[model samples]
Target: MGVQTNPCLVVLAAYSLILIQANITPVLAHVINQTESPATAAPQAPPPVAPVAPVRSAMQPLQATDLLTADKPCSHGLERQMPYFGMGAPGPSGSAGIPGLPGAGGAQGARGERGDRGEPGLSGFPGSKGDKGDIGAVGPQGLVGLEGLNGTKGVKGEPGRDYTPPSMSAFHVGQSSNLQVTSGSQIISFNAQYINIGDDMSQHTGVFTCRIPGLYYFTYTFRAYSHGSYGLNIDLLVNNVVKSQIYMTAMSKHLMQTQSTIVTLRVGDDVWLKANANTYINGDDEMNVFSGYLINAI
Candidate 1:
């Protein structure tokens, strides 16, 4: 009675409210369980995200038109070209290299031409003479060579002077003095002379002296007149020595004898006649003569 509602309408309204409560209650219960038991909940997959691009400066992009066109101002468009790098100057000369090993010897060269001849040298001095050698043995005689022509005759020589022979002579006696008959020897004195050349005869000594040495000839003649029986002997003496003798025996008559001889006389020699003792001589000038002469000079 309060308004006395229709019954059907009221049932319908309650039913509709019940349906809304059923759906709202499940949703609320699910949220409550997730909050209470997170470990037990299934993980959810995240959504897909886009890739990030590289960071870029705030510059404009380059283009072929900006590079080709020189007059255009492209300050932030073209990238600044890097500066070209050139090779540097050659480095300082390296240090001197080490000395290398010696090379092989070279081949022999060709021979040179011959030189000109030299001048002649001066002569040497002569050497001294050597000593004489010893005499060698005598060799056999060699054959004689042919004779040469004869020479002309020479002039004649002068004639030599002639030589004269020594001359001496004694001839006759001038005086008679010896007239005795004695027993001993005595000299007969022919007291005179005729030719006594060279004055070699002496009248006083009754001797003939030789002036020159020579060969001489002597002659003596004696005449003895004796009264009684007596022997008369005469000797020719040379230098007081008897060289020759003459002997005669007279009974009464006068006896005459002549004797001649040759004798070699030296200088200063003497010749004289001596009578024997016991003989008498009549000293007569004509009979008793003693003479001598040089035949040749010695």
Candidate 2:
């Protein structure tokens, strides 16, 4: 049996062994479909993956869904994570941030309960009663009403100089005994009371110039007859100026008088005579100077 093999070379050796088993059956099924499957053990092909930058654990807190989880890393990725979408509904609530500094003074708030009486103001109409005061003056005629006494025997009046006759009257008008004054100037001298004109009108020196102009109560009598004499720049001239000046006294023949000034005269007021005749001394006497009024303050 071993001597026959040439039936066309045994069909070309079984068609070249079926064309090399059909090219080794697709190279053994492409090595069994690139072969790692003995219960799935050959997929170790994931080593070229280098985009992993999300390992933040400095004591961990990175969970915004683990920042786009892919084991957290598309190079810090939750799809490049920054999409919180939460600001749209809160736009109307942002106007209250300026009140933080007044918090330290808040412990005194418990005293408020007394306010319920405010509704009664409309009834005013009655005020008019005041007028009754004047009825008082009928009393003067009762000393038992009468006069009965006549037992006569008296007449001894005349004792030289106990003088007191001046309800008011005086005058002086230059027959010059001294008159020359000028310093805050004022000069008015008069002396007169002549109903009987006797002692040369009793010590003569009277000039009566202003006849009638209403108010005229005045008096200025001055005399400093020696020792550094000074008194009488007599100022009480109503319309010719200088209304008040008559003060003199380092006196000698001393006759300083002034205090009855109530003037209002106006009609060429020429109250004359002012003497500072350097302290006049020819028998010291700025001779009885006078001016008067007060027949009732004028």
Candidate 3:
């Protein structure tokens, strides 16, 4: 079996070497005196020791004879020296030292994580009112509204002063003279009375005088035959002013014509029919007539 080498022998050998270098060799001197002659006895030479191979080799066995009892071989290599003892046991740890000055500041650390959000703040006070602006342009007109309801009926009006029973102040007169010749531009004095309500007409003068202040409608018809190229022409006058007229050419036989007008008249206003120069009217069995009637009163 191989020998188990001891580790304590290595520590003891290192301790002995440290003491010898520091010149603390009193114990070493005593050990040498036990194996050598006194220094004053005589200058004696010591015996030599030959180098020996290490005993740790597998083939070699450790023996007591390898360690010399008398003298350590100083001429031998230090590595050849034998390990005799273990290092002294470690001393107790010393007391804590005084504190030192603070060290220099280190490099800046990494950024930290983000913090949580904060709560909302209270609402602020309301602001003051602003000044008024200029007026805007007018907008487009709106659509028309629906029609309104009919009004109430009015009271019945009183009869007019010149009005009589069958009709109002009105007249229808005719002339049946088969051929009435015109001496000049004169009034046609009609002689036949078909209707003369209120007697507001004059058969002699051929004029109707108004007795009411109102609008009146007048119409007349004449049956006639043209004699020559000077066609028949007639006039209906209101107060000496021509209000209506008609003309006929000589190219036809007996025929008929009509003319009508509306006018606003006051009391004493005259309305009449007159034949112009060179005009003839037929009787047509008394069908030639002139008429007038009040339509509205002021």
Give me the candidate number with maximum lDDT. Answer: 3
The local lDDT score (0 to 100) that residue 218 gets in candidate 3 is: 92
- Per-residue lDDT of 1-298 in model 2, one digit per residue for the tens? 5885444445446545755664466556546654657566664433333333443544444453432233423332323322221123334566667666655766889999999999999999887987887998998877674667977889888788887854333343322344445344424333333232112223333334554344555554444454564544444444445556655545556554544466655444444334433333122234444544423323
What lDDT does the true structure give each of the candidates? Answer: 0.70, 0.45, 0.72
Better of 1 and 2 by TM-score: 1
lDDT of 2 at 277: 34
Model 3 global lDDT (CA atoms, 0 to 1): 0.72
**TM-score on alpha carbons, each prediction:** 0.44, 0.17, 0.44
Residue-level lDDT of model 1, residues 1-298, one tens digit each, is: 3776654455446545755664576667666777888898875433333222233233534334332233443444332221112345667999999999999999999998998888988988999999999999999999998998999998998997898754655444544655665677777666677887888888666788898798889888877766676667889999998888888886667778788889999999989888887667776776778888888888
Model with the higher lDDT, candidate 1 or 2: 1
Error of 1 at 240 (Å): 1.9
Query: Over the stretch 1-298, how does candidate 3's per-residue lDDT look in tens digits?
Result: 9987554455457656764653545545555765686655554444333233333433343344443222342333332344332345678999999999999999999999999988988888988988999999999999999999999999999886985644378888888775444457767888788888778899778899998789999998887775665456788888899999977766467778899999999889999888877677776536788888889876
lDDT of candidate 2? 0.45
